[model samples]
Target: MKIKEYRTQFINALTPIYDAGEAESFFYLILEEKKQLKRIDLALHPDLAFSEEEIAVWNSILEQLQQEIPIQYLLGKTSFYGLDFEVNENVLIPRPETEELVDWIIKDTATPRNNQGLKILDIGTGSGCIAISLAKNISNAQVFAIDVSEKALATAKKNAQINAVNVTFINQNILETEDLQQQFDIIVSNPPYVRNLEKEEIKKNVLDNEPHLALFVEDNNALIFYKKIAELAQKNLVPNGQLYFEINQYLGKEMVELLEKMNFATIELRKDIYGNDRMTRGSVQ
Candidate 1:
């Protein structure tokens, strides 16, 4: 059938599960990925027909979409921080907010002669997005990432390879680790900060499909990972070494206070594109 003709059916198939806008966007993204056809190509050539086999393949994918599967998982790849990463059920798909966090790290570390060969660690580096991006952007930095899930680290390692960046991947439970064996000039994380109570606030696509190990925390101790990481940062970071986090917008003030009580200096919180206080940074004195 003509690709343009499929658009209506595509929207209809997904409308019950996703909104019109989201369904339409998925259709376009799939068309581009599968057929190498742009939106304008569909618009300008409404009669461009799909082969019977192509239609069948699209039908199967559409059924998955109707069942609420994420488009990124369906494609098995996603773009983040200007790099393409392979993702699956094991790793959370990198988000634009996290891209902002990566940009923040890159800009902060790009100063001339500033820790040019410094060691850096990215905690909870699901899909190795932050670690790989940093290594790709900062020419002289040594990067490493830690995750408790071996499967997640596998995906992250693949991403580093695909991005042509060298990043050491380690599997360890950060909360249980007593100390970092080696000091780092920078430590960054986008750890699980969503409280159990706030699960209702998360979109169904996220709460249903994304890995919970990478997304949640106990409501009573929502800052558990941050606290532990801060303790390690105190002992592991060299003088004036930096610590960065992509934070929970709702807990910005608490995070700032936590860092302050830890005696972190030069604490700063910044808003993301949505104007939420979504990232924070501080330096160990």
Candidate 2:
């Protein structure tokens, strides 16, 4: 069958569940991945055909998409911070807002005070996105990442290798550790900050498919991970070391307050592209 004709059927099948724009996007994403054909290629040719075997594979993916499985997991890969990462049920798919948090760190460390050797750590580094991105961008950074789930760490280690960056992956729960045991110039995390009450706010695709261990916190103690990581930062951060977090949009005021009470200097709360308070930074004085 002509690929154009199949594209129409594909979009129509998903338009009931996803919007027209999203369904169209899924069509093109699949087209590029499966056929190595971009949207323009299909548009210009208007005669590309899908073999019966290819149709079977696409139909399988379409069925899963209808079931609300994330396209990243369906594709088994995603792009973040200009690098590729393999994602699965074991890790949360990295988001664009997290990229903003990473950009902030990259710019901040572009000209470090001591550039010879810089140490950095990422807490709850689910996919190792932040750690690997920083290590890839910053030439002198020695990056380390920690996660409680060994399975998550395995994926992260693979990502580090795939990105050709060295990030020491550690399998330890940050909440259970007494000391970081070493000092770092920077510490960053995009830990579980979604409150239970906010589950309704999450889209069905994410809530149903993403790992909850990397997504949720008790509503009453929404800052549990932040507070614990901040305490550890107090002991582990070097003098004037910086800390960064991708936080829940609703809890910006509370986050700034938490860092303030902990005596963090130069605290800055920044909004993401959507104008939501999505990232915060504090420096140890």
Candidate 3:
């Protein structure tokens, strides 16, 4: 069928689950990935048709999309911080909010005031998005990433290779670790901060499809990862070194308090484009 006709069908199939605009965007995204054709290309060549096999392949993806699987997983990759990252069910899909956290880090590291050869560690790095992006953006950065899950770390290593950035990958659970052997100029983590009580607030697509281990914490200990990572940072961070996090929006005050109690200096919380408290930074004095 013609491109526009298929586009209409694709949107109709997904509108029940996603909004009209989102559904339309999904169609164009899949089109570019599967057929290498842009929206304007389809519009210019309205007669461009999908072959029988192509239609079958697209129908399979549509079925998965209807099942609430994320489009990023369907495409097997996603764009983060202006770079493409490979993703799977093993790791949480990188979000725009996380991109903002990355932007904050990049902006800091790229400044002329920052020293060269800055040592950075990304705790619980999934898909190596943050670590890779930092290494790619800050040419003199010495970056390392760690994750508990072997599967997730494997995927992250592959992503680092794909992105053409050198990021040291380590396999270890942050909670169980006692010390970081080496000091770092920065320690950043977007760890499992979502409380169990907040599961109901998560979208069906995210809750059902994303890796829960990378997404949640016990409600009673919602700041579990933050506390652990902060404790590590106290010893591992060089004097005046920075710590950053992609924080849970509802826990902004709690996060600030936690950092303050830990003696993290100059604590700052920043909002994302949507005006949610999505990023935080502090210096270790």
- Model 2 alpha-carbon miss at residue 41, Å: 1.7
Compared with the true structure, what per-residue lDDT tens digits does model 3 show for residues 76-159?
A: 999998999999999999988988898888888776669488999999998999999999998788999999999999999999
lDDT of 1 by residue, 140-229 (tens): 899999999999999999998899999999999999999999999999999999999999998887888999999999999999999999
Which residue pairs of candidate 3 clash? none
Worst 10 residues of 3 by lDDT: 106-115
lDDT of each: 0.93, 0.93, 0.93
- For each of the candidates, the C-alpha root-mean-square deviation to the true structure, in angstroms, is 1.3, 1.0, 1.0
Model 3: lDDT equals 0.93
The best candidate in terms of lDDT: 2
